[model samples]
Target: MTTKRKPELVAYTVTGEGEKAYWTRIGSAWAHKDGEGFNLDLAALPVNGRIVLMQPKPEGDAA
Candidate 1:
């Protein structure tokens, strides 16, 4: 049996730039067993924004 682990990266829809930039949580990604690709699950797809992948923050830490 296989167990699911927490996502290593968080996906976001980004708009604007610099201090004015906005980030919206859109999905999560899990690396494949072979480490050659990732499995992405998105709640919504953006039409006019860019998708950015970043590491998840530690619990209780906000930046």
Candidate 2:
């Protein structure tokens, strides 16, 4: 058995063409113990530059 913690990073959509560009929250990630890479939890990875890793936005800023 194991426990879960707050996500270390978030995944989102930031890829597409001109008018098609859009943003959407997709998943989260956790830093690996080795500090080499991350353990990802994603809905689905995009083919292009469709996903990016970013810190969670500050609370109460906006939705």
Candidate 3:
């Protein structure tokens, strides 16, 4: 009996000095059942940047 991993939309942004300053959708996140941590399924990790994980924003919550 195996449980499926819940995937959450994760966003990656290039920041800091000497790195590409841009924001884009990088990949999906499979969170653990315990709500402690998760894993990312990225197409390719940016050479220089930062990675941020969060649940997908609601369509009506756009600012």
Candidate 4:
């Protein structure tokens, strides 16, 4: 017999300007994506995990 575990809740949002990504909660054990909607295996991430939108830094701010 197989048993399914309840998914833990985690909050995340989208990155780019494509879809309207509201602050939503998802299971910790579920594979989630960052703001770019990229595929990320966040099954081991904490509930407060934050995925930042990695865009090219500005020329002056490229430190």
Which candidate tops TM-score? 1
Q: Is 1 or 2 the stronger prediction by TM-score?
A: 1
State residue 26's C-alpha deviation in candidate 3, in Å: 0.9
Instruction: State the C-alpha lDDT per candidate.
Output: 0.86, 0.78, 0.65, 0.36
lDDT of 3 by residue, 35-62 (tens): 8986667876876757766687766886
The C-alpha local distance difference test score for the whole of candidate 2 amounts to: 0.78
Q: After superposing candidate 1, which stretches have Cα over 4 Å from the reference?
A: 1-3
| Per-residue C-alpha lDDT of model 2 across residues 1-63, encoded as one tens digit per residue | 133877889898777767886778888989888999988888777766568888987778773
Model 1, 1-63: lDDT tens per residue? 133788879899988999998899998998888999988888988888689999999889974
Ranking by lDDT: 1, 2, 3, 4
What does candidate 4's lDDT look like per residue over 25-60, in tens digits? 232332234543323324233345554333333457
**Which model, 1 or 3, shows the larger TM-score?**
1
Candidate 2 has what TM-score?
A: 0.66
**Every model: Cα RMSD to truth:** 2.8, 3.3, 5.2, 13.5
TM-score for each of the candidates: 0.86, 0.66, 0.54, 0.21
